[model samples]
Target: MSIMTQLEFELEFSQSEKQIAKYILNHGEEVLSMSVKELAKETYTSPATIVRLCKKIGLEGYNDFKIKYSAELQYDLHHTDRIDVNFPFSKDDSYPMICHKLSSLYQEVIADTIKLIDFTELNKIVDLLYPHQHIDIYGSGNSLLAAMSFQHKMMRISRDVNLRILHGEQVFMSYNSNSSRIAMIISYSGETNENIQIAQTLKENNTPIIVLTSVGDNRLSHYADYILNIGSREKIFTKIAPFASQISIEYLFNVIFSCIFQKDYEQNIQNKISYDKKNDFRHPLSSPVSDEIK
Candidate 1:
């Protein structure tokens, strides 16, 4: 988790710790230049209290906390253009203005999402998934749609990815899952009851879980062996649409698919090409104007 997110969402801090966290969050860039004692004095706390706050959030000390927090602050300053994820445009906006605003929203959300990605964790997920012939996915609503898209892409590469639409069927699948199978659960809020139930079932069976969720501490994250975060700028109930979450989820799935494909690049390419030739039924007019691959 990013330091900014951890500071914002972590619930175990005491009153003095919360005060220190609030001070750092409000004056992020300025804190980079100050010593631990200086920060403690400013927050009206002792240096030991500040260090304890840093360690509580998983940092080694104040300096380590500052380094990570400073990077996040800089990234936010550069990439976040104040695009409102909940309402990117107003009702009276022109079509052209709407187009531009939506486009900018997509760009900014993707940029913010990229900052949350940990390549080491992603590589571990790919390694765990690559050796499995079958995988199960669980989600609801829009998140389900994203999972279905990933299922389709993996199927094209000869992987059996299962998705059950019905709640009972999903529960049944989860109960039957074993350590041999890997399951991925997608929940934006990470608090969906059905998703939590499925995650629990999988956990009892010793199945490794991969979670795709928004950045913050949540229920679903507890069961996950690996987590991939989506852009988390949107409000759950107030958004006009799930524009940011949808795009971020799709982008993460695409990156996963592409990375897995690259693991056996030549063989996968040949397999796709061979499948295309065998399945081709298009007329000459329907073919590409310049067919270089053929």
Candidate 2:
């Protein structure tokens, strides 16, 4: 977890510690240059209390905390582009301004998603998915749409992916799936009741489960053999829409599809081209003159 996320989500700190955390969050760049005593004075606490807060968050001491926190702050400043994930635009904005804000939001979400990826875990997920002829995906709403998009991409490459939109069918699919099939569960909150039940059911069948979720601890992550974190800056119920979560989920799915394609690059490329040519039915005005694979 990033230091900023830990500070925002962790609730074990005392009042003073939370105050210090708030100060750091509000003035992250400023905090990067502050000494332990200076930070303590600014937060109206003692240096020892500051050190205790650092320890509580799993750092060795004030110095260690500063080192890690500074790196995270620097990365955010450079890559986040300072765009708000939850409410990227306001009512008074012009069309161009709205376009710019939405574009920046997409870029920021992708950057954040990239930072959260664990390459080792990603490799493991791709390895597990590559050998499976059929995969099962479980999600709801926007997440389900992202899964369907992924399913479409994999299908072009001669891989089968199943998704059940109805709750009863989802439950039945979970029960029927066994260890031979791999299941991917996508839940932004990572605490969705139905997703948890599916994860539990899949676990009982000894199936390997890959979970795509937001950062922080949640019930769904406990049952995952591997977890991929999406951009997590938006509120569960307060957003205009799930702009960040939806884009992040789609980007992650694209990454997974790309990685899987890379596993057998030549064959997958040929497979897609072959499928496209065989299914082509466009008129001359809309389609390429020659349907040759280049």
Candidate 3:
């Protein structure tokens, strides 16, 4: 996890830690320039407390933590210059410029998401999913759209994926789920109340729940059997759209689909051929209208 993400996760555990984390996050640049004593004085804590917090987060001391944190902050600043979510496109940007910025943003977010993924945990999720009798996917709005895409791809491979878009239906389906069922709950913030409620329902029913959420601490992670993080660096002022999160979700889903398909490659191909032959239709010829412009 990134420093920001780690801080967010730590916030849910302790108040003193939260105070330190909040101060560092809000004044990262200042923290980089300050000494351990200065930071302690700034956050109204002692130097020993700062060292303990640093060690808790895996650093040897405040100096080591500050160095690592500065490196990450510098990297973020360098990479996020042009494709910032808050200032995605300037008014002076031409169409081509806008397209380039958008493409670059997608590439960056996808690469960042890849770095955050744990292959071992991902493969475990796939292992858990492969043997399940039913797959229940829960989401709302744009997330539901991603869920439907997963549903379609899974169905093409002859897997039964149930998508519940409505809040009540999600609860109902989760309530009916069993041990043989797997629930995938997707939310950009991972704090959606309805999704959290559905996750609770799935847990109560003894169904394993997997969560795909933005990279940070959130309420939904508490209920998850497996947590997959999606990298999205959108700021509060950049709530104009969920572009980064959506792309990350879709990219992750595509990866999962590819893994599942590779496991049953030949069978999946045959299934595709069979389904296409049954559903595909050709438009009848229109008397060679290409040559005559009547």
Overall lDDT per candidate, in order of appearance:
0.85, 0.86, 0.78
Residue range 41-114, candidate 2, lDDT tens digits: 99999999999988876689999988987777676577564877778889899999999999988988898899
Q: Per-candidate TM vs. native?
A: 0.72, 0.73, 0.74
Report the lDDT tens digits of candidate 3 across residue range 99-159. 9988988887888889989999999998988766588888888877777888888888878
Clashing pairs in 3: none
For model 2, which pairs clash?
A: none
Candidate 1: lDDT of 262?
90
lDDT, residue 273, model 3: 72
Q: lDDT value for candidate 2? A: 0.86
